[model samples]
Target: MKGRETLSNRFEDGVLALLPRLRRFAIGLSRDRSDGDDLCQMTIERALSRRESYEPGTRLDSWMYRIMRNLWIDEQRARQRRSQTFASEEAGVSIGAVGGQEAAVEINDVDRALTSLPDDQREAVLLVMVEGYSYREAAEIVGCPVGTLNSRLVRGRDALLAKLGEVA
Candidate 1:
């Protein structure tokens, strides 16, 4: 009992430290601020409940990300089954470091481009480009081959560049 309690406490602390990154990933996955926030909360709750399943010495962030992604995928499937779709609110540009008006506009442009990518590509970009995960790590999280992940990133990056060019 004591061992479990100590593990839970440590897990909770680790989770607290990762909230920002987790929330950002959630928003990226869900494509809406409100839904992302809800997903983040659910992920935290799920992780806490299943803390015993977490392997010590593994990357906690990666584990949490996988949980969040799985939850998002499940939610997407449920929404599809119900034929329910929600309009995405504008991506919140202020989530990043805002230097000035120009920077804010650029950030908004990037966010729009990112959100416009296909789900697979968007996930790849967010995990690799935004979140700084290696290809192998991201592949494991998304449950795809490393080659597939690379292809998605290349396509996503190209699309983003083209979209930004049009804006420019």
Candidate 2:
């Protein structure tokens, strides 16, 4: 009983510590705040239900991110099949919602530029830049070769610079 209690507590702590990042990643993937919240909720539920599958020594953030990414992919496919018009909806929330300040507008511009990248490139950037994962770790999380991950980052960066101008 004590062992189970300790394990659960540790898992909860690890996941809770990552709540902000997880929510932001969820928003990045879904492009909609409501959907992002749903994804975050789903990730937490899955993690709790399958706590035993979590390896104690491994990076908890990576595992949780993998769960969120997989769920996002699945949701995308499901959405694609349901309506071809869904792409239009992916433009995401308005900039005003981020904040009324100028800095928020710049942040929104960056976010919009991020949305312009291809899905693979966006994922690579999210894991490497946003999540601050090492190259090898990001590659592992994205399930791609290191070279491929590098290419995606390069291309994604170039695209962002072009889309958001030199300020990016």
Candidate 3:
């Protein structure tokens, strides 16, 4: 019982310690603020419930990221399935009905730019660029080879620059 308590404490500590970074990564991945918050909540809940699967000596952040990525993918698939009944093609035009031009306009533009990226490219950029993970580490987190990850970084960067109007 004491050993289990120690492990539980460690898991909780791990979650708390990495929460900020995890939430940022979630935002980058989900692109929608609400969806990102929900994703982070779901990831934390899943990680705590599945604590036995965690290896004590491994990188907790990476493990947590893996959980988040998998959950995000699952959620996307579910959303796709449920949206089949509706015409998603038309829904893209319905921006959230925000009023006036404020600082949030820039933030929304950035989010839209990031979200427009392909899944692999977006994840690669988020890990390598946003989170400051190494190429090898980011590749491992995304379950891709280093070369593929590098390619994704280049593609993602180019796409982002084009979309965000950094390169005229």
lDDT of each: 0.89, 0.85, 0.87
User: RMSD per prediction, one decimal?
Assistant: 15.0, 15.0, 14.4
Q: Give the candidate number with the greatest TM-score.
A: 3
Give per-residue CA lDDT, model 3, range 1-168, as digits (tens). Answer: 999898888889879999999999999999998999999999999998888899899999999999999989877865764565354666756654465576578778888999999999999998878766669768877888999999999999999999989722
Q: Tens digits of per-residue lDDT for model 1 on 22-58?
A: 9999999888999999999999999988888999889
Those runs of model 3 whose alpha carbons end farther than 4 Å from true positions after fitting are: 87-168
Q: Sorted on TM-score, highest at the top, how do the candidates line up?
A: 3, 2, 1
* Model 2 local distance difference test score: 0.85
Total clashing pairs for each candidate: 0, 0, 0
Candidate 2 deviant stretches above 4 angstroms: 84-168
TM-score of 2: 0.49
What TM-score against the true fold does each predicted structure earn? 0.48, 0.49, 0.50
User: For model 3, what is the error of residue 86's alpha carbon versus the real structure, in angstroms, after optimal superposition?
Assistant: 3.9
Q: With candidate 3 superimposed using the best TM-score fit, by how many Å does residue 21's alpha carbon deviate from the native? A: 0.6
Q: Where does model 1 exceed 4 Å of error?
A: 1-3, 84-168
